[model samples]
Target: MAAASIMPPHTNPPPPATARDPTATVSDPQRHRDAPTPSLRALFLRAVDPSRPSSWSTAVADLLSSGDPVAALAAFAAALRANPAALRPALPPALRAAAAATSLSAGRQLHLLALRSGLFPSDAYSASALLHMYYHCSRPLDARRAFDEIPAPNPVIVTAMASGCVRNNLVYTALSIFRSMVASDSAGVVDEAAALVALSASARVPDRGITGGIHALVSKIGLDGHTGLANTMLDAYAKGGGHDLGAARKLFDMMERDVVSWNTMIALYAQNGLSTEALGLYSKMLIVGGGVRCNAVTLSAVLLACAHAGAIQAGKRIHNQVVRMGLEDNVYVGTSVVDMYSKCGKVEMAWKAFQKIKGKNILSWSAMIAGYGMHGYGQEALHVFTDMRKSGLKPNYITFISVLAACSHAGLLNEGRYWYNTMKTEFGIEPGVEHYGCMVDLLGHAGCLDEAYDLIKEMKAKPDAALWGALLSACRIYKNVELAKISAERLFELDATNSGYYVLLSNIYAEAGRWKDVERTRVLVKTRGIEKPPGYSSVELKGKIHLFYVGDKSHPQYKEIYAYLEKLLERIQEAGYVPNTGSVLHDLDVEERESMLRIHSEKLAVAFALMNSVQGSVIHVIKNLRVCTDCHAAIKIITKLTGREIIVRDIKRFHHFKDGLCSCGDYW
Candidate 1:
């Protein structure tokens, strides 16, 4: 913490005192005065003077100790001017100190000095320091230039350059250098540090082929046993977006489990939609006693798993643990908690968690806004967006996506359009596919089918399947068979293997009473061998998720659940609720269609939840598909009759039913 300079003792002498005399002193004596003190630059020059035999090393060291890289460089420059040969040996240390301070301009000046003295590039340590300084300053090109100047660089120098490239996001260049190093046996075997850096770059680039190659190299070099290297490789495989979970798991299983290892695996599972496995691994981690305790990362990953699986009870328990560990204030953990509660249909809890997050950044604010949007609280989402701007957090691309989605869900067409325009004109964020999709959905939901189609046509980027799907969905809602067919054709061409689009088209046909077209669509689906995945719903109770598919009777308590559902159905009928058989989209008789509607997955899950959960507790169900119109209406009646809040999170947004009303206001 010392300053980079200290004035030499006696360099600036104090003024001499004049002796006072009696009335006759003026004629008797005259006083001599000391010379004026020298400036700091003059003292520094004197310290560097060769004739005076001063140590420029001592002066440079004292200047470095001042903790100011700029001042240190100035002293070093002065020393070099006075006695170039004496200070040439001290250039590397001065450059290193400047690099450490991240003073790029000063470091560059020292680098120039090294170059002038012919001590750079030929001097491996100096070259590495310059490379590091360039990386710190985000000057990758300069770093590359420094690296290229090295003649026959050693492994340490090569590793430093490669690591710098990775740190500067020059992954392809890093990989190239790494490959050259590996190919040169004369350059020495690739060390653990180089391999780790290569693997990190591979993961960021998401080159699974390179990742595999690195893995093989590591294994061949016997560095696989190193715990940190193994963890990095595991992360590489997990995040490479390849379907090689087996490889990631194998590596994870073989490694000595650290807190990071566990977190990596849990986060991988959560990200890949294997939420059940994620929660199970979390449980295993808790049960196994060791030095590996859960940290903010572990809690965040597991909370994401809870959100995905709709494991509310488990999420609550994890939230309590977050509080106990005092990690609730950690931004990532806090954001995860908000996202978890929001996705799990607990908007109130999500808001509470959002409120407690100190130093909320754009990500935290976006999470809260998205949580409100997902729960169909469009106005609240917009209000939060306003507050975020007022708090001086600029809305990024992701923030705008969330805001537009909220407007879409709440049928705020004008608000959606205004923001969509403002996002580009004011915020300078070009509308990406997600923003376009939200806008299409907003328009489609508002019955502006032609406008939605025109917008798709005018998109800067090619419209993707999701955009077409939104249009098709809108067509179905408004019973526009012609547009629905057009949308379905585009969607099917893009994603031909997905049977859901075909089913949607058939549904649209059936709604229009075009039996022949429905038959043709069914034949096309069969011809393509595309099977629609069966829908299922899950309800988490007592930290365990219970799944129920349509017509499912596999649960241990299925009989009780069925009997309760039957009685509840009768009561709902008595309460003047009639079955809407049109949702079946089949040629069966009305009675048979009604029977099918009764066994819908969501209803089954709701029945089981009611049978097992305590009275007055909220029922949360996660569905694999969008809720049907019949189910939506039925749930409203069920909530009114049972006098309990029921939250159903389908593929789209949430539906919170209480007293014959839903949060989506019957629009979604």
Candidate 2:
């Protein structure tokens, strides 16, 4: 298309040539030879076109500054027709307009004009602008070709080229270009922008060796002392290149930090599962980052940490801050608050937060549905899912997993089967491994063992350890030793290192009185050095976390906690709570197994929470493993005796115990 058709000429006369940033033009080497400071009309009137008036270049700049890029292109064509020399000062703005509009067609025409006018090789500003234009338009190949056409690139041109490659996810290529920038002669010396690009590349590929090299170069060039480059490297570390939390913490401790710096470190700690440390860093930001008030990003990251750690008190405080800052409507922070409350075992609070989100994105809807599902409210989750679809947001694969899981817990087998069968046909989502696992769990929970096994056999994707492990757990509950053995074989083959599977199979064998099989499995586990993660329960009370292991006495208040637990057991037994010693799978006599059942980790955590917190307050306990059947029953009775609501989150799902019953209907 012609330039006039692309951007028709405007009837209004354009303003002066010096309308945009003075630097937004191709640098002219000889233009300074004119007047020391030219008048407004002659500002860009270089001697290259003494015959042409400066107004030709003036029109292009005016249209560009006024945000009329289409009109700018038309004026650019007129300027070129008047004098080709005008391109030296007028080309950069036209390229800027192209980049801003993300128009590759207009940019390509300008690229041709720049090449034909002999400005590409000499003008650094024009070359950089062209590179940025191609980058913004998402044409990486054109950017690389434009970059290659330059003979001797300056630092600006090299930085621009590296940045474009990094933006396009050609990280290794960006690294190569950065290396050349460092190795080339004086004109291509590494600058702050080039260093940041190289650091970003190192992070994407997650090559610690490359990051180390760049880190050394940054230090040698004294860029490490600057906040901009330092924060970039911190971000690289956070993304898991060498993931050296120690080095990252050290760098974080020494650097002159900004809000971005604090946010990166917090995200790094949280991502590495050091959520406690992440929360600590956020606290430090409040105290040490004197001028750096918390922003939506900071609150979002810290709220996620709170969710993972069950730091509800800290989460509530952050929510209050979000309200104070009038960021209650921020999609990110609002969604984070919902997730925090949901995972921390406060679904009612999550619903409140979910309702307050003004622009509820897909993530917000998914979080709310998952929250309802975890609380054993299958009907509520389905209703919210329907509302999500009505709100014009299509459910993704993750949403289906939550739906099926809710069905599994609430015994909605028909609904679960309908969603599983139609996920591909209705939502166009082929069931992935996670979806398959959720379906297996759902079918197995409903005692449809034959059908669950058949589904596993018919799966298009390979069955993972989680899928087989689900079947093994179901077999233990349903007393199907035959299928359990087959599931065990597949589970061990896929993930031999998972100690949980070995324990699950052993428990199945033991519960069946197949002592020989149990002994054999235990011997195999011992020989392979497989150790199950010790079960521990944690309760977040008043911003401080309390941990309890089986018969734990490590706390300073162990005396009071143990004493309280004994009184609770007596009271619960008087109220018809029987200690279900059947869960103790070890080869012990009935008395020893009964004694062992009295002090399970979750019971101790509940006792501690009961003693420390105010009367009638709800207690939340987070477990690192599945809650045993004995503790599940006892907690339901404890909720009744203490007149409190106890929420327990195990590895598989959340169990809400209130009024002498569990939300799972004693099924899970």
Candidate 3:
């Protein structure tokens, strides 16, 4: 292709050159004779005379204020063609900065102009600036070509190229270039050292080998512990995952920590699930020293700490501070609020906070969807997901995870399958193990156990413990002992140390009346030293969660709780209720078994919630396990007898019992 065709010509000419004389001047014979040779800058200064007839040199300077950089570059190119001497000073920098600020089309036009004029390789400064423009415009290959053609790349040029890679998330390429530069003969120089040092410091790339190499080089140059480099080093170590808090703390102790250092340490602790240490460090920062003012990042970090601790009181206080600080609408701060409320089991508050976000990005949608899914509001979760799509926010992997989970809980089997297919068909997202697990759970919980098992067999990647466990839970609900055994075997084969699968298998055998098989399973469980998971129930009262386990009688009002249960039983029996004695796993006499079924944790929590609340109040109960068969029966009776709606979120599904029936059709 002809080089001229690359840069389209300008349709409009520039203003008269004399108008730009203030910014640049032209060299005359007398001036060149006096100076012998004029510098590129002096040539522009000498050219700036309004009395001098307009030349191409002054026209190039006028392009800076053109508002449209593409047109400016074209006019400047036309001017350069008219007077080759105009590129002496202002033209190169002006063209470069303008290209950097404009679109790729404009940047390419500048490159075309340089190529057509044969000035691209002749001037190193202009060439470097052109390279920087290409880097800014996200043409990394073009940047590499520009750097390679520069003959001798300077530190600034090399750093710009490496940084472009970092910005584009090609940290692998950044490390490669840094490695090549450090192995060079003059690695100890400030220019080369700064490039590698900054790369190591930024934490964009998390390879200890590469960072350690850079650290050694820094020490070779006697440049260790410089605050900027140290901060970068600390971030690299913290984010790299191999480095421990001990090393990070040591680095922090040795260096003079500004806000960046403190923030790095606090964030590192939070990222690693070390919330206690992170809060401790934050307290130390406040009480031990007083100079540091917490910025938005610092406050968000502490807010995350509150979320993890489930410290609603502290989180609310921090939220108040966040509002007072006027960051309630900030996306990061808002995300923290959504996460805190969701983890605190107040998803409505999370949603309320999410709706107030002035700018909703992917994180905002993901947080809200996840919150709704956590609260078992599957319909609300699906609604928010649809709203996200209507608002033009493409669902990412995490968003899909939340949506799939909602479908699983709500038994939207066909919708779940459609979205699962859409991940790869429309969005080009290959299903990960977690996504596959969600699909299995969705289908398994929907009474499509055969299809769910087939899905596990059909997965591109091997199914993991989570997928098998989901199938096992479904088997337990549907009383499918055969598939339960298959799922149990698969789970044990993959992860033998897990005791939960053993319990699930044993429960399935018990539910099926296979006593011989149950005893065999018990022997296997004994051999593995597996313990069954304890049952727990949570009731929200006066903004506090009151949890009770099986056989729990430690409550201050246990006597009243039991008494309420007795009266409630009397009323339910009067309303034609019968005890579901079959829930007792052991083979015992019906009367003896019926007596034991009344003391389940969920029943205790239900009785307590009824005693504590007034009539007509909706009782919300969250259980750690699937609602027992006997408890499920009793809850249906209690709902009709007491005229109350009870929402029970069990491990496998949601049970909405109203007027002697469950919303799940007693299928789960």
Candidate 4:
């Protein structure tokens, strides 16, 4: 059983007859096949001869070039043991290779070798290579250890360490490193690249003081002309949660415009509810025509603006443009398109766009569900959710919010409660305030006020003003004066300056025949300097937005609009429509109440839409506030009389009036 007899020579294979001959005392094939392979250390020693200095370098190079840093480091260790002098020159290259390959263990070993050989602190290149290796491996502490060992770190090393800290969510640490670099002249001067990294870190921390300081430093260093840095600063101001839009715009205007600059400004405006200004700036960007083509980002931002502004025609044009640019398949742009169409009262178009999306993500599905929910298509929303689950996509918290909201709007109480429990039990998503708010709204709408109150009491999180306001609105609808008063008291404490709450409380008093209380609430409103914001309705026709305020007579066609509205009112009244004078909430006579209801913004906007747009066309109107009871009733009658479908989107949700009925079935 000699070892050389059992094993064949390097150049020869074992004989086939020996494999088949059990009588010849053949070695077990399975045992031979299961034998342990040579270790990297053994392989390295076999490749190099200690007496040959050239052999050490050649063996290290071959191992390093094997595309496996682990094996390469073992060869490097053996070479170092054989001849440290010969391997010293190759250690830096080995470290660099390990860094490129993202070999953390190999890099650590090489790092130790450099430190032991006294080549670390004195050799900036080797130290930088080790720092880079640790950064790529996402080991910030190791990167810092290597960085601190550098006796005189240069700008490149400082930037690398700071970036590593930022990438690892150590923004404060990165900023400290950057400040230290600035304080010490060891790195001579911090360049724009380092400043960019510092600005990025500052943005993540969103420290206003740090961001302003970085801005000053960037200007003082004359790096303000750098477009990329300026763009990053602009994003910091706009999206850093502070929302310093004025500063963001100023910075944006000062920069020489690029596609990114336009996109950032458009997104900032859209996010801050300045839809008109956002669309205006988008138009300006197109008009300036500096060869700045609209990309997916631009289209998404502008589409969102159109959605907010209820510019259906404008949104449709953008949709056509998206198709032309072949960006309809992009998840973000497709999601925005669906949102715009849905918010603009085009749920059918939203569904079509959702289907066109190549690979639908969570946002895409959620947008469609939200669209259907907003339009009071609750059953359709539930169907989409079922399809989403079947497609193997797990719904997130936002998706459940939309589903629960759909249920609330459609009076699907049982479904709403079932999903509310399922969110916690099945998906393990603890309900947030928004989810609880929707549940409260659902119960309140269904006349289960006591149950809603009990649920609120059981809430883990404190209810916000909006949640209280939902309960108060329900009280108003159901004429529960006592609960309305209680809800209003809580709402007042949370938001005393909101005039709508005071007006709502006054209306509740009037509904309950509490005249003195109504007067007292009105006096409180005046004393608090809470002026009710005027409600306006806007309809986009022929790509131009026409706005109508309460009793608005400023438009050049106001006379015609009023005349047309008077005639339309006569027709709706003849169809057995009685004005809901109770909604006036004033001490005026019956005649005055009817007159006030006639000139409501939604009524005026509807009249204008009838006179301007073609017959049988779906009229889309957006109101700044909720639609009043009188206007809501009147629109239903008008739609039946004129044989036109009217879709009105208010602050709350969509109302579709067709053939004397609304999608909400008179519940909303």
* Every model's TM-score: 0.80, 0.81, 0.64, 0.75
- Per-residue lDDT over 1-668 for candidate 2, one digit per residue giving the tens place of the 0 to 100 score: 23433232223333344543354332333433222222222333322342353555555666556555655665565555555555677788878777866788888877876776678867898899999999988999888887888888778888888888888888888999898877874642887888888888888886666777888888877777888888878777667467767876777888888888898888878777677898888988999887987789999999998888777888898889999998888888999999999989888999998999998998999899888888888999999999999999989988888888877777788988998888889899989888888888888988989999999999999999999999998898899999999999999899988777887788888878998998888777767876556678999877887778776768899888888888899899999989865542543222224454447789889989998889878898999889988889889998887789998998877888998999888777
- The local distance difference test score of model 2 is 0.79
Candidate RMSDs in Å, in order, are: 9.8, 7.8, 10.3, 9.9
Q: Write the per-residue lDDT of candidate 4 for residues 1-668, one digit (tens) a residue.
A: 01111111122321122223222211223322222122243344444356455665555455445444444444455555555565555666667556656766667766766777788878876776677778877888888777777777877877878887888888888899889877876433678888888878877875566767888988876778888888888777766646677887898878877899899889989988788888888888988838998899999999999999899988999999999999888999999999999999988999999988988999899999989998888899999999999999999999999999999988899999999999999999999999998998999999988788788878998888888888888898889888888888888888887777777778888878998888888777767777557789999889888899888878789999998988888889999889765642543222224444447899999999999999879999999999988899999999999899999999879999999899888876
Q: After best superposition, candidate 2 residue 534: deviation in angstroms?
A: 4.0
lDDT of 4 at 150: 78
lDDT of 2 at 530: 67
Off by over 4 Å in 2: 1-147, 168-170, 185-188, 205-213, 570-599
Per-residue lDDT, model 4, residue 170, is 89
User: Model 1: runs farther than 4 Å from truth?
Assistant: 1-114, 129-149, 164-180, 186-188, 202-220, 559-598
Give the clash count for model 2: 0
Q: Model 4 misses residue 263 by how many Å? A: 1.9
Strongest candidate by TM-score: 2
Model 1 lDDT per residue over 1-668, tens place: 11223111113221122211223211122211111112223335435344332466555555445444455555555455555554455566566656656777666676766777677878876777678777877788888788777878788888888888888888898999899888896534598989988988888885557788899988887777788888888878877647477788888877788888899888989998899889998989998826689889999999999989988899999999999999888899999999999999888999999988989999999999989998888999999999999999999999999999999999999999999999999989999999999999999999999999999998898889989999998999999988998898899889887666776788888879998988888777667877556788999988889999877778898888888888988888888788765642543222224444348789889999988889999999999898977788888999999998999999889999999899888777
TM-score of 4: 0.75
**Ranked candidates (TM-score, high to low):** 2, 1, 4, 3
Global lDDT scores for all candidate models: 0.80, 0.79, 0.69, 0.79
What TM-score number comes out for model 3? 0.64
Model 3 error, position 149 (Å): 2.7
1 or 4, which is superior by lDDT? Answer: 1
